[model samples]
Target: MIEIALGALITLCLLLTGTCLWLLTNQREHARWQVERDARDALRDQRIKELSKRLDAYLTGSVRMGEELQELRRIVAPLPDKLNQMEQRDPSSLSFTQAARLVGMGASVEDLTQSCGLTQAEAELVSKLHQAQRRKS
Candidate 1:
């Protein structure tokens, strides 16, 4: 009977050891899964932060462009009034036609802008167009 009891105690100890090992293995697997989940969450949060910063910059640029457009409109609003005043002063002096004529005659862009009231860009465009026309002819 004593031998049988010793055998039974050994069996119980082995079963307890196996249970403890299995519990430890399960706990370790769960810890690994938790770690992976935390890492993924952190990466996702960092991406969101970066995208938010980019979106804010885009919004700022859009607002700046809108303000610049408003200022350009403000500056251009008086052009019609000025054109009318110039026309009243001298109806026969059409500046754009005069500028184009001067461009065809090989006038400098500065001369077009000063003497004929053309912008430098307008003078350049007229010069280019007349040059192209002359080339085609």
Candidate 2:
């Protein structure tokens, strides 16, 4: 009976040691997994910050472009009325406008006189003005 009790005690001690070792290994595994998860969360947060900055820049540029477009629209709105006024003021001015367009398209003085009914002196003047405007630009 004494020998049997000693053997049972030794077996119980071995079992307790094995259980303790298993619990320790399990705890270490959980700690390692938590660290890896924290690292991944940190990386994800960094990426989110970078994307947020890029999105802000893009939105700022878009707003700037929208403002520019609005200004362009405001400037262009009066053009049609001005054009009508110019057309109503002088019939000869319309011919001059047409002759200027022809000159801009590389028309010769003769072409302007024939096609646009501009006088020779007027055609020459238009050609000179077009040349000067091109040089200024």
TM-scores of all predicted structures = 0.57, 0.65
What lDDT tens digits, residue by residue, belong to model 1 across residues 1-137?
A: 99999999999999999999999999999999999999999999999999999999999999999999999999999999998678678865556766778887889889887887777798889888888989999
Candidate 2 local Cα displacement, residue 123, angstroms: 13
Clash-forming residue pairs, model 1: none
lDDT of each: 0.88, 0.92
Evaluate residue 14 in candidate 1 and report its C-alpha lDDT on the 0 to 100 scale.
100
lDDT of predicted model 2: 0.92
**Stretches > 4 Å off in candidate 2:** 93-137
- List per-candidate RMSD values in Å: 6.2, 7.1
Tens-digit per-residue lDDT, 1-137, candidate 2: 99999999999999999999999999999999999999999999999999999999999999999999999999999998998788778765446778888889999999998887778999999999999999999
